[model samples]
Target chain A: MRIFEYMGKELFSRFGLRVPKGRVVTTAYEAAWVATEIGSVAIKAQVLSGKRGKGGGIKFADTSAEAKKAARELLGMKIEGHTVEKLLIEEKLHIDREFYLSVTIDGGAKKPVIIASSQGGMDIEEVPENKIVKVHLDVELGIHPFIARNIVRRLGLDVGSRQGKELLNIILAAYKIFQEKDAILVEINPLVFCGEKIIAADAKVIIDSEALFRQKDIPYIEEQTEAEKLAQDLGISYVELEGDIAVMANGAGITMSTLDIIQRYGGAPADFMDVGGGTDMEATAKALEILLAKDPKVIFINIFGGITRCDDVAGAFAKVKKEHGIPVPVVIRLVGTNQEEGRRILREQGIEAYTNMDEAAAKAVELAALVPAGSL
Target chain B: MAIIVDQNTRVMVQGITGKQGSFHTRQMLAYGTKVVAGVAPGKGGSKFEDIPVYDTVRAVLQEHQVDASVIFIPAAFAKDAVLEALEAGIGTVVVITEHIPVQDEMEFIAYAQRKKAVLIGPNTFGIVSSGKCKIGIPPNQFFMPGPVGMVSRSGTLTYEIAGNLIAAGFGQSTAVGMGGDRIVGLTFIDVLKLFEADPETKAVVLIGEIGGNAEEEASVYIKEMTKPVVAYIAGKSAPPEKRMGHAGAIIRRGKGTYEGKVKALAEAGALVAEMPSEVPEMIRKLLA
Candidate 1:
């Protein structure tokens, strides 16, 4: 879960971090007022994804009139497919130096690792190796004063300076927030030093998905917070790998088997999604919205029935095909419990069903191979 | 020698008074798991499935002398419940509850490691010790004591593989659903080591999904194992850049994906089965 800048800054303040004074605005009028109050503000479009500057999501304006214009243009602009719904206008800082600091879960190590660097405002990834210092911490130890002191020293901060002391406090605060929020990553990209004061210029936080349940406010913006929303939305649970053939199966097992079969037939799967055990007509139709939207060359539905009735799955496909037309070629693999009824329904409707996973995979691969290279 | 739980393992139930806790508690009981005691705050003196219920894990442990626990607590209470169980000297703790906070899990996993205790899942189905016992929510009908040891991150995939193994005239010594959470207690390598040491288990089946380097890390261990290991990775049919499935399954930039793990495992000499269903057959061949 991604929390917006304003909320994150509020958290920063609570943790005794020095965050630059900022106010969020929803409309251009509000942005203009904010610019007037802040004086020489940085107007930034609220985007959840990283690299907002690259997407022209941030603009600096000297006057309120300029701030309004920038906000108006950014209000409805789409940066990285997310429409800008809000704008955060912040007070500009006169900075002498910028530093990088973040704490993230290192999944491989099964512990939280703190990364602090002298390189700031540059993507932490692109920062030179010498500029970046990584600190591996055992979670059992939690946040120790010695580790915090080491990070401050590694960044080459002048411990005697007031700004250095302030920056150290902010860094420790960020780590506390990371631990408290169950954050996958909490980054203060440019902890700026402006006239003997350390302030957070920009903040980014990525919360852990596993921790969302305890963090109640996190789900208010969730894609599925209610049963009604889930019932209406089409959600296929599977990872999307780099492949060309798309597979739709009833269970996770059959979906994986379908992927294997496709690979064996000299083709790669475009996606892996299971419609779950015995889905509804609307759900099947929604699955198409998710699967076909990927624009795959071909689709193969592998349904091995048990609690998941085959004819019900077939009926879902038939309904989806009738309502929303699918552009790509498709293959149906119906087996197990409702094999007879499902096969008969498909055959009667002039759609073919294969009992063998290999044959269906082969046909899907063949169809995918026929797609023009440029089209694919 | 399967991982985590095996035939001789004794199990206790945590949060046994709640609805889900009671229901799965019955299922675990029916599966022949030696569920000696139950724990629920102020719900002691009650009997669930004819098993003694205590107010706390400490009380349950003192009376029952049980070392392992199956947690049926809700997500909100999951962290504290796990902490209580671990603090009570439980040897292996299986947290069946999903949605544990990552911060809570980070603390729990670290604390458990420090205590030298095995914590299985934060979002797990639990562990099955073949026909003798089940300390979690796996359907009892699919398992029979045999030579193969299985460990998986996915619940249903574990069931499907175990079912196929049953159909193939093979059975399992133990099947551990390590849980699909990113901060789960036991990694694939942790369970693989136990399987390697188990005497009853001749081979191991590892069901891996597309995400994380857990499988790759386990593959390194598989090469050192004396037993044959069959491996299968899900998400072969995954679309590019889609973050579906479990949170751990998300594809990062240049790390923890299906393709990289596959190459690593294949090089480690584990026969990679692309299809989930074929894993049991592949294991059978490897064991033969």
Candidate 2:
């Protein structure tokens, strides 16, 4: 999950890392009050997205009136589809130099990697590979002092200088946060040197979603759509897409492949929903309801049940069809465990089910094409 | 003649008395797997399905000559469970548990490599040697004994493709689910090497999705293999930055794109299928 800048800074402060003093506020009045206390402030929109500055989600103010004006403009502003609900009013820094540092998981290497560069406050991807230094660390032997020192020196910092020592300590602290907090990414873009002090100008911390059960104290912002939240509650996975056919399947791979097949047959998928393994009648019915809410031209249900039973899924389609009556053209390809019984259940509801995935997908695409544009 | 599990492979069930454990245990047993023992802490000295249940793997090791152990422990305690199995000197460990912390997985995967052991998955459906042994929770009816070896990152998709292959008169020698997590124990290259050496496997099918560079990396290895490989990648139409069910199934920063993976596989001489249904026919043509 993506942590807000203020929250990430709070975590960094807990690890003895220096950060500009700031307070998150939801109202312009509070923003003005914070600016009054801090003298000059940088009003940053607290949304979980990058390039906020380029998107006009960030502004600077030297006076209380200017802070209030900036806050009024930023609050409720949309940047990259995220509404600005909170603003971090922080003391602006006078930086002598800017550098980049981060600790993130190297998925291909299967290890934690430290990425440091002399360039800062820009997309690290655009930076030339020669300017960036990456070091993969062993989980067993964490970030030793020498490794941190070497990283600092490689970025052109003298090991004996006080600035290098401070940067090294910050790097060590970032690694500590990455390990102790179970974070997938801990980035401090533009670790600025202001006269005699170094401070993290920006904090981007993303914790491992699977490790959230252990990191109970971390605050989570509700960013999921209504359908996504419902799916999460049902122990299923749902991702909304822009298409005419709604796709549902028993596994992530099969669901994605089902979408691929629909696209192959000149049809677009409206959403991706996986009912998950071992989904029973009620969850399947709920999944159907969620897909129907998307109001696609066609509802394609594909099940290659392994732990999930076809009969149970068919029972769900039957129950939903009887209760509310499915309004869309429903195409199902049910196979695997108890498939004959599943087909029987669907047949009783006057719903013909296909056994072959290709044929079923083609039929759904054909049905979807029959519906005129804006007919729904 | 399979690569990993065979008829002679002795298996043990971790968390044997739990809901998922006992249920799949019966399925494994029904499929003719040589399940030798079970481990459910505090349920030691008990018998589940007449298989002696011990509290720990070390205790179970005293009696049973186990070749592999399949775990069904929950995510919270999964680390210790995997460590226990590994420390007790089990050569092969298959973790069926999903939602295990990636840190714990990194630790165990590194440890497994250090010990020179084969660890299957932290979130996988498990491996199946057709007509011989079944380790995880795949439907037994879908598999048939034949010559095609399959490896996939997804579970039911493996079953779907396997069913299609069976319909085309192509049975699998062994179908392995390399797990769905970002950091899995085995990679496409690892399993591809195994299938390359196994004489029973005449052709290979690799099912990959949009995530990481696993398939692109595997494409490099596919060029070196003499065996025929048919590849089908999912998530061609999937949008970027959205986690499509699996944690690892997302495209970030324009990396791990479908086009990149498909082009790499096709350029490396693997027959890349446009759809899952096309995979069986591709395998047939290659084998023919």
Candidate 3:
């Protein structure tokens, strides 16, 4: 889950790392009041996307009036498709220099990697390899003080200097957050040197979703759509798309392959829904109900059941058609365990099911094209 | 002959009394798997379908000479269960549990490597050596002993392609699901190496999706194999930054794109199928 900048700063402060005092506000009046108290604040929009500075999501305000004006413009503004809902009003610091530091999992290496650079406040991908120092850390032996000090030294900072020691402390704190919080990524961009103190000017942290059960104390903001939230509650996976044909399958790969075949046959998918393994008739009905809410011209149900029985999926289609009355055409391809019973159940409802995925996908595309665009 | 498990391979079940564990144990036994012992912590001194249940892997080790361990423990206590098996000197461990914390997986997977053991998956459907042994949860009806070898990252897709292959008069020698997590214990290359050295396997089918560079890295090894490899990659129309059910099946930072994986596999001289249905025909022409 992606943590908001304000929450990440809160975590940073909790880990004994220095951060500019900030207050998160949702209204212009609150922003102005915070600016009056903090004096000369930087108004940063709270969104999940990066490059916020280039997108005009970050602005400076010297007075209360300027703070209100900036907050008014930033609120409800769209940056990379995320509407700014809250503003972080923080005390502005006079920075001498900026540096980049982060710790993330290297999937190929199967280990956590630490990346540090002298250049900051920009896309780390755009930075040249010569300017960045990357190190892989062993999970067995965590980041030691000497390991962090060496990373600081490689960035051309004096280990004996006060700023260097502060930078080392920040790096150690970032690693601590990465391990202690079950975080997948913990980044501090532009670790600014303000006179005598080094502080994390910006923070980004992404915690492991599977570890959320144990890390319950960390605050998380929901960034899912209503349909997505419904699917999550139902224990299914759903991704909304802009197309006329709705797709549902038993697993991720087969669902994606179903979408791929639909596009191959000249049809666009309205959404991606996976009922998952060992799904029962009730969960399948709930998944179909969520898909029908999109109002696609055609719905494609593909099942290559291993543990999931075909009869359960077909039973869902039958139950939904009988109760809610499906207005759109549904093309289903049922195979694997109990396929005969599944086909018999659908046939009793006056619906014919295909046995081949290609034929079923082509039929769905053909049916979708018969409907006029935007008619649904 | 199969690469991993066969009729003679002795297997042990962890969390054997749980719902999923007990259920698949019956299936594996019906398929003629030599399931010797089971570990269920407190349910010890009992028998799950006549297979002796012990308190721990160490207790089971004192009785039976087990070769591989299949785990169905929940994600919270999965780390301890796997460590117990590894500490008991089990060579092959297949973890079928899903939603394990990635940190826990990293620790156990690294330890498995240091012990020189083959860790199959932390979130997989397991492996089947067609008609001889069944480890995880793939339906046994679709498998038959033949010359083709299969490996996939997804479970149902493996069954989908396996059914198609059987329809086309081909059966698998072994099919391995490497799991759907971002960090898995085994990779495409590791299994491909085994199939390459196996004498009974004539051809291989590699099933991949939009994820890390596992497929792209496997392509380099495919170029050196003397046997033919037919590949199919799913999620061609998937949107970027969206986790499509699997934790690992997203395109992040402009990496692990469908086009890149397809290009690498094609360049390595493997016949890449555009759809799952096309795989059988490609294998027919190659093997014929």
lDDT agreement with native, every candidate: 0.77, 0.92, 0.92
What is each candidate's fraction of native interface contacts (fnat)?
A: 0.49, 0.74, 0.79
lDDT of 2 by residue, B45-145 (tens): 99999999999999999998998999999999999999898888899999999988888988988888887889998789999999999999998898999
| DockQ of predictions, in order shown | 0.40, 0.81, 0.82
lDDT of 1 by residue, A1-116 (tens): 77777777777788888888888889999999999998998988887767689999999888999999999999989986678999999988898888888999876677888898
- Model 2: per-residue lDDT, tens digit, A269-331? 999999989988999999899999888999999998778899999999989988988999999
Docking class of 2: high
TM-score of each: 0.81, 0.98, 0.98
Residue-level error in angstroms, candidate 1, position A358: 5.4
- Tens digits of per-residue lDDT for model 3 on A145-263? 99999998999999999988988888888999999899989998988878899889999999989899899899767878999999999889898988889999988889999999999
Reference-based lDDT, residue A239, model 2: 87
Model 2 segments beyond 4 Å from truth? none
Model 1's TM-score against the true structure: 0.81
RMSD of 2: 1.3
Instruction: Summarize candidate 3's per-residue lDDT along B124-181 as a digit string, tens digits.
Output: 9899999999998888798998989999998888899999999999999999999988
Judge candidate 1 at residue B180 and give its lDDT: 72
